[model samples]
Target: MAETREKLLEIKNLKKHFRIDRKHTLRAVDGISFDIYRGETFGLVGESGCGKSTAGRTILRLYDASDGEVKFHGENVHARKSKKELKSFTRSMQMIFQDPYASLNPRMTVKDIIAEGIDIHGLAKNKKERTERVNSLLKTVGLNTEHGNRYPHEFSGGQRQRIGIARALAVDPDFIVADEPISALDVSIQAQVVNLLKRLQKDHGLTYLFIAHDLSMVKHISDRVGVMYLGNMAEIATSKELYENPMHPYTQALLSAIPLADPEVERTRERIIVEGDVPSPISPPSGCRFRTRCPFATDICAKVVPEFQEYKKEHWVACHLYDERYADQMKQ
Candidate 1:
């Protein structure tokens, strides 16, 4: 299915770093590259501080990339452009933030909040059109017209996220960056929001970069999944391929930790316990970032960084254990 579709966004060697001091710099997103295909939900999953959010923001051009190119429909996202060009670019892409509580303006009514994009882009011709558009959006996101007059503080966490979704959809974007959008909601509300996203995608043919730490939900929502470790992409493949046959040690450890529903399978499965805490990104370990805690680490693991390469069709991994070129030395 992904083979025939065009690439919506191509991220090449993308890096986002913050200068902490003269001697140290935090590498939040360090040289990771991937393609998000049209009309597919590409999931980025990792630990809390593994730079998943940073990567998403960089791809969206919300953060200035330190290195690399993000091409959106063959146009370089980070390149200098006129205000009109930038506005057009922004209209084609939108972001659904992680925290709904913090994202929405507490003082503004829901109608005004959702129409901010419409007003900015000049999508509506007049106040009547704007009110109509806002009301329609509220209904589209499962809220009623009456809810539009209320402030963000009046809604539940789930409803607030719906309003966020409505705002993103208000712009009629081709691509959306959903950065852990469901992470802040209640467990029951999470499913509802996820279902809403799926429905919206089908209805609007929306492409999404869904970033989160929840493997179970990611597996459920993603067409393809990329696992990140300490700002490095460890593995990426189709959701089925990644879950059924994860090639990297970090991916293996992550999958093993997901609790199975069946009691027998849960009891029989071997847990791949990753030892030690994740190293600081400010001074990330040299060579392979995962080498410090990788179960298959050898001397070469510390001496050289493993290249991210495809082992099989659509399955990519970065680990010395899977590199055929190092097979001989790994035996020692």
Candidate 2:
């Protein structure tokens, strides 16, 4: 059984929109809500351009929200905060970016890059202490202190990611937003990084908002998972629950695409091919965002947006098919 922990972050109706050509608006994270509990890995999975990364950034306040509130430890992250307040918040919440090579400063040495947060937050008392901290962090992420003086280009993709993890952990943050941290690494390296993250989480009791497009990996590492489609959340549930009984059509389609290990299952299972490319967020289809491609879409789906509601305990979905009023009609 999963441990029920306190809520570390409360995101309510969060929206991050970008203005295009001064006329059109691209709603990256259109209005999504969820809670990240203390010491839990909450995975956000979606197709490319589905706004998973944008949502993660918006949650960390890297990008100012267009609307809605992100509360971390009961403080509104989107609200105006003083430098000290912001710094204090920053110290508690950190991010491990997607691209390891690009995220790290090519000019700076690994030690300096890792210790940047320590210097900014004034966590270290002296140069000796900072050096020790940097070296210790390098060791913690499975890199040697000797490699500390080397540049990012010298390290492999996995090692670069390890550096990224060390950088994020340097500040000893309670919450981390890992936006596709393993997507760039080789297949073999991906597992190593994921395992390293898990070990670190266990050792430090860290909470994570792990955003990725890989459903299999998300299921492996996450305690709970949320599925997004076209900048809108379609389903959310525990990893086991969601994988075993996916509720939304979009979620079903995504899971169906994952190949099964058994030869018989793989051969016989009918994949739910989502028809049509994803609609643009600039002018998203009215009512249900997925209605255009949903095979079961009806007039009601086109006319009224389905409310995101729980059909079962802890299993929330946004689809007309799951609506209680339409349950009987759906059966027919």
Candidate 3:
């Protein structure tokens, strides 16, 4: 089904680096590539500081890329554009930030906040039209029309997130980068937000790049999932396949950490405990980022960077164990 879907966004070797000093640079996102299909949610999961958020921001052009390209509908996203062109491009893509409290402005009323995009894009003809559009968006996200007159501070975290979602939908964007949209909310509220996003996608025909550290929630929402490690992609597969049969050592370790519901299975299942702390992104390990902690790591793992390639049908992995050249070594 994914093979037939149109490629909405193409990201190639995307990298984002922050200059800490003249001599040192922190590699937030380094050489990751993936394609997102139209009307599907692509979940990105990784430990904190693994560059999941950075990758999403770079793809959206919120932060300038240090290297590589992000193409949206075959047009270069990082290319310089006229003010009008940029505004037009922005209307096609929007972002729902991580923190509901920080993402919204306390100074602006909810109506003004949701209408900001509508006004910028001239989607609404007049004050009456703007009010109607804002009210409609509020109700779409399960918020009451009356809430539009209130400020951000008056609402709970979940309500504020609903407002944020409504704001993203104001321009009727085709693609949205949901940067850990539920991580800040309570577990109970999290389900509501996720359900809202799923329903909105169904209604609006939206595509999503959902970035989160929570693997469980990601599995619940995404069609495909990409696992990131120390700024590089470790694996990419269908959400069900990846969770059931993780290929990369890093991916296996991550799934093992997700606590299951059944107490008997939880107590009896083997856990792949990855020892050692995550290396500094400024100076990651020589070749494979996970080599230092991977139990299956061989000498080639430290000497040569493994290519990210398709190992199984639609399952891509970056690991030396699957390499033919190192196959004998892994066996030994």
Which tens-of-lDDT digit does each residue in 211-265 have in candidate 3? 9999999999999999999999999999999989999999999989889889999
Task: Write the number of the candidate with greater TM-score, choosing between 1 and 2.
Answer: 1
After best superposition, candidate 3 residue 144: deviation in angstroms? 0.8
Return whichever of 1 and 3 wins on TM-score.
3
Best by TM-score: 3
> Model 3 residue 13 lDDT?
98
lDDT assessment of candidate 1: 0.94
Steric clash pairs (candidate 3):
none
Write down the TM-score of every candidate: 0.98, 0.97, 0.98
Whole-model lDDT per candidate: 0.94, 0.93, 0.95
Misplaced by over 4 Å in model 3 are none
Least well predicted 10-residue stretch by lDDT in candidate 2: 323-332
What lDDT tens digits, residue by residue, belong to model 2 across residues 1-332?
55566899999999999999888999999999999999999999999888999999999989999999999999899888889889999999999988988999999999999999999999999999999999999999999999999999999999999999999999999999999999999989999999999999999999999999999999999999999988889999999999999989889889998887799999888899988898998999998999898878887787788888988999999988878787765564
